[model samples]
Target chain A: MADLLTPENLVNALSLGALYALIAVGYTMVYGIIKLINFAHGEIYMLGAFWALLVVGMEQATGINLFVAIVPAMLLCAAVGMTVDWSAYLSLRRRLPLADGLSIGGLTLLGVGAIFYKLTGDTTHAWYSEAAHGVFGWSIVALVPVVMLALSIGEKGGMLGRSLGRVSSDRLSALITAIGMSLILQTLAQLVWGADYRAFPQESIPAWMNEPSFHLGDAPVLGKELTMWVVALAMMAGLHLLVSRTKIGTAMRACSMDQETAALMGISVDRVIAFTFLIGSGMAAVAGVLYSVKVGGNISFRMGYYPGLLAFAAAVLGGIGNIRGAMLGGVLIGFLQGFTGGTFTIPFLVMILVLLVLPRGILGEPQATRA
Target chain B: MLELKNVHVHYGKIHALKGVSLEVREGEIVTIIGANGAGKSTTLKTISGLLRPTEGEIRYEGGPIHLVQPSDIVARGLCHTPEGRRIFPELTVHENLDMGAYLRKDKSGIEKDREHVYEMFPILAERREQHGGTLSGGEQQMLAIARSIMSKPRLLMLDEPSLGLAPIIVQQIFEVIARLNREEGLTILLVEQNASLALKTAHRGYVFETGTVLMSDEASSLAANEQVRAAYLGSD
Candidate 1:
């Protein structure tokens, strides 16, 4: 603990925390408004990094390349985020009667999963002999019918329908859809980019950017790290202002509280929700690019998976729907990595602790808590 | 002016509002009074474009508002302050008021109306920075109405403004309703459970029962009718 108290470690912790906060805020903001966990947010993060890598001159990033990388990355991610929201969640939500749509959606996904499993059997592991390699694909194919059957019985107005209709169709279905969205994004990434562990081209970084320019009380701070920290902090501050001061931001807060009420206020709930996703996804994009640079310039399809999970933990720790809570949670989670000397256990431990002890979260309120 | 003709609304399998017809002229306080399940609130919600009527026509300013989106309806000079004090719980009072004028692009107008609302509810001015949820129930209800007022509506639909409030607060709310109608020339469609209070405050009243209107007349006549008095106003 004493050795870890160094300025270098503290700087690392802060940078890591900034990344997690960027991702966590997406989860919390989505949850705050529509109460969807938006499990696909991790993939958004990954896509941001991937998109940045694809931007013009990123591979040979010299002077201004790195600075300009985030723009395209964020724009692409925001577009995808909004598109996914409209196509996946909105279509289901907009249907006249939710039950029919949910059943059809649930069934269609399962059928598609079946077709994918039947055809490729997960080509990533085609060379391997283990039949379980395609288990994730097979499981979705297998589970949908059972879930559908159980839910359909509720359509006949049984106790389950009366009690669990909102829970199952709205909350549970959205959650499952989110998980499916995450998997779909990963699969799509694999299909397009392949399952290779793609690396951020190290040549993109100017040598001076990686080398320490100044000392933070004897701890040398690299230019890239300084750049990332500043960008992340600025984004956080920008988010706070946007949510607090901007007209759209006020609409977002209103919708988060009560969509019906917001609608009466002449605030388009659909537009506000789309805006929330755009902002959150944009932040994830910035985080993705920054983290890629920080982690030895290596990028992968699965990079966001663990970090996304940790950011979620950070969100819950601070309070699910509270913005400031998410920021605090991210910093705390970053400190956990440093304090534990880097381990997988600390995050889960913190999450489990938060769930058990602080159910509403540190700053979360009873209902519609957004700031 | 607003008119609903043969409006049919359903909540899933249950028909919540059945062939409900109502109207409010350009400058009047129209109240619909009923028991909890009478679909009075549903009527206002349907008119606000929050709930779509399965069948029928809703015309605002002689235009079909039923086909319009809720925000569009509000933008076209209609607003609904829903049942319950529905405020952005985490947002400050000022923010809540700001959201009320969300569709308005005129900055100076918004500022002017905001000051007007603060004048109407002085307590809200003092609690401007406090979160909406932290306010007392009466205060929240006032904020809800004040927030709705910020929209500058030609026709405002208030659903049960007196619900769960003390008599004095209810009186205060009703006085504001009367003042808005008298001074601002604003038309109001009010849904209320307090039949006596609503009848006294409104220019006209409709009695609702089981998803349909049982009676419609001038407020004093409804108050005087033996059956209406027995059913809603009580023996006193």
Candidate 2:
């Protein structure tokens, strides 16, 4: 118990909590508005780490400004998040024909992934000859239609997407589709960045951040821990204000309550939903970058799986649709994990028990409607 | 201001509306009166672009509007207050009012219109911070209308405004409706089951029965007709 009270343990726990809180904020908001769990959100976090790894290469020429990677990482995450919704989730709500996922989701998440990294020296059993090595090694214009043609080969795969969008989108079907999306994203990450573990570059960790002792006396706080807390808190505050005070925020809350009514107000429910995805995915990216910075990138295609699940547990444990509840839930779970010495299953067990006792979780609305 | 010609609509396979036609002139109060499932609501929905016509044309202000989305239609100055007072129940009254002008960009104009709506409904001003779900049924209806008013709609379509309300509250609501039409010259298309009250409030009215308009005439004439009286007004 005394070991748990140490400043290092406490900082680790808070920083972990901050990571979960950032991801959970996005996770919970997506659920709050659209009622889809977006199981692929974890892959978004993983991709964020990989994007930072790309920036590490840039640092060789551009000096050690790896933080600049956050911008492209966030933009990429936002685009992927928004595209997934437009192609996979939203097509169900409107009567429009479905399975346009490849047009943007594929181009950005998969096609763009290929362009960033070469495959010749990376993967074995290479499909290309010596002349065609590493994804054209030059032109993006030549690859667009070929990838689209590959995706459009048959409706057999699109049958699942079309049926889900066209006929029934009850919670069970939606959940299944979300799980499928999660797997597809994982595969995309595997195919693009490989399944090997990558590092966030040692130099990216500023020496000052590595130095311990942020307090006057015996209490020690690494600057990296401070940076994590500050970044997460600032983003969360900005999100809170945006949701509560802005016209766009009002429209978003309105969409969460009832979309048909929101449309009547000239609010354009689709635009608000897209904006929600942009914000939520960006928050998840911040969590990813912060985690990579702190851990020196113990990053892999599967890395986001644990953090994503834990953050989801935090979102549910706090209250699925409430923002503050999600943040608190994340912190509490982070501490629980820290004190238990990485006995991670206990958090799930706790989540199940808490959910059985309170189906809406601690801060969820009693009525099952969004707040 | 609005015209629907031979509108046909199907809700899944049910054929909710078929070959319905009507028109609403500028600055006129037009009412569609009928019993339950008479397609009055469906007609309003088709006009407001909530549902597409399977075979028909909807023209607003001399342009084809049948293909427009509901939000775009509102931006074109045709606002809809749908049935059952579907206000954003979780939003504060002020935010609910703010969303009414979602497509507008003029900051001061939105503020001015919001203040105007507040003056029209003082209870709303007092409860600006309250969630819409907490309001009384009549107050919810008021917020619904006031929300539409904030958009500065040139032609307002109301679906069952007095639904499930106290008689006195209904009277108060009709007075406001009359004032909006008279003072502001706001064109209105009201759908109501209250035949007696609707004929009184409207300049002209259409009698809808089983997805078709059985009769259309001056409101006073429609009220006097024995066939209309027996079927709708419950009189000799």
Candidate 3:
């Protein structure tokens, strides 16, 4: 027990918790606004890590400072996050009656399928078969926008529009779409990066970053751990100020509380949501880079899944929508996980126990009287 | 300053507004009185751009505003204090008020408006650091109205400000509303279930029944109408 509670383990726990807290904020913020789980958030973190790796590789060839990779990685990840929202969630939200929108999407798939068939022209011929398969590969590129336009117009005119407007229940569809997005992102990552674990070239990093900066008793604290702590805390503080003091941050809070009322207050809901994604993903990018450096310097297509789930658990543990709660939960979970030697069972049990005891989490507001 | 011509609104299969038409001239308090589902709130929502009208037009300052987004409408100085006083529960009163001035770039003007709001609802200023959810129902409503005024709206549309409040608190709210309109020349469109108080406060009144206007006239005439008195204004 004494060995487990050593200073080394405490530092490890803090760094790990800081990473989880960073990613958890993304989940919590997105959930706060739209009430969607944003299951693809983990993939954003993974992509950030990969982006950092790619940029670091460039640095090695050109002799640039490897630390400079953080900026582009964060920017790229933010763009990716925004694109995911634009392509997936926003498109569905704009279409009233998610079923109608889905059907239109289905029709577009069929249209593209037909176009592929025409291009193939008798698949019995080897050349034709290859052409058909190639066409099939590009169908999504050709058909998605076409279908979107058709449905958008249909939503604005005639009986279809009226009927579409009648179905106001979009929560279920949005949830399903979120899950689908997770699968799509995971699969795409696998296809692009393969399922192998690629080691980050730690030697390329500055020697000072890799060396121990200080010692606690027998435990030596590496400069990398110190860096992670400083960077994570700085980013968290920055986020807190941005949310609490900035105009856009205030708008985000208002939208989270009541979207229609926020809109009525002249706070553009769409703009606020987009900004939320940008900030959340940027933080996740920073977390991803730090995590890769600290944990064996390896990057994998599935690297984000376990940490992402743990961060989600951290968010829920801290009271999902409360920002401070997420931070607290992340640090607590990180310490607990470190103490337990990275076992899932203890953390999972903790989450369940916390839910059973305080269902609203630590900082959740008390239930208000229903009108 | 605002006109709705044959406006229709639908929520799923329920037609909330059926060709509801009304007008609010500059510097007037126009009240819409009705039962729970009589489309009074819907009419306010349509004008505020929270709900898009299915048919007809909403003209604000001589331009069609039916197609405009809600945020743009508020930016144009049309603020709606919505039903249920949807204040950000976790935000402090000061933060909530800050959110109200989101679109305004005039820092000094916003500060002046903030002072004016504080003057009107001194309780809000007293509890400026308290979260919105901690406030009482009456305080929340005051915060809602005070927050709206922070926007410096040209046309303020309030929905059911007295829905669930003590009679004394309700009276106080009405007094503030009347004062704002009287002193500041602020135009208002007030929706209320409290017909007697509404008619007393408004210059013009519209009686809404089952998604359409049943009558429109001067507030005193509507208060005197036998049908309106029997259906809406309870016998004293």
Best-fitting candidate, scored by TM-score = 1
Off by over 4 Å in 1: A6-8, A56-64, A95-166, A216-219, A365-371
Better of 2 and 3 by TM-score: 2
Per-residue CA lDDT of model 3 for A1-371, tens digit only, reads 67688787888888889988999999999999988888889889998888888776722544445578889989999987886776667757665454566565445434533554455343344334344533443453344445444445555564544455523324544555565555555544444444557755765467887789998778788887888899989989999999988888888888888888888888888889999999999999988887888776468767888889999999999999888888988998898898877788888799899889999888876654423
Provide DockQ values for all models, in the order shown: 0.61, 0.60, 0.62
TM-score of chain A of each: 0.84, 0.81, 0.80
Ranking by TM-score: 1, 2, 3
Q: Compared with the true structure, what per-residue lDDT tens digits does model 2 show for residues A137-183?
A: 32342343343333333223465434544334345444654665666
Q: Tens digits of per-residue lDDT for model 3 on B1-236? A: 99999999998679999998899999999999988899998898888887889998999999999999988898888999999998888789999998899899999999999988998899999999999988999999999999999898989999999989999999999999999999999999999999999999999999999999989999999999999889887787
**Clash pairs detected, candidate 3:** none
Query: Model 2: runs farther than 4 Å from truth?
Result: A1-3, A58-64, A95-169, A213-219, A368-371
Better of 2 and 3 by lDDT: 3
lDDT of 3 at A335: 89
Question: After superposition, which runs of candidate 3 have C-alpha atoms over 4 Å from their true positions?
Answer: A58-60, A92-95, A98-169, A202-204, A368-371
TM of each candidate vs. truth: 0.90, 0.89, 0.87
Range of the 10 consecutive residues with the lowest summed lDDT in candidate 3 chain A:
A120-129
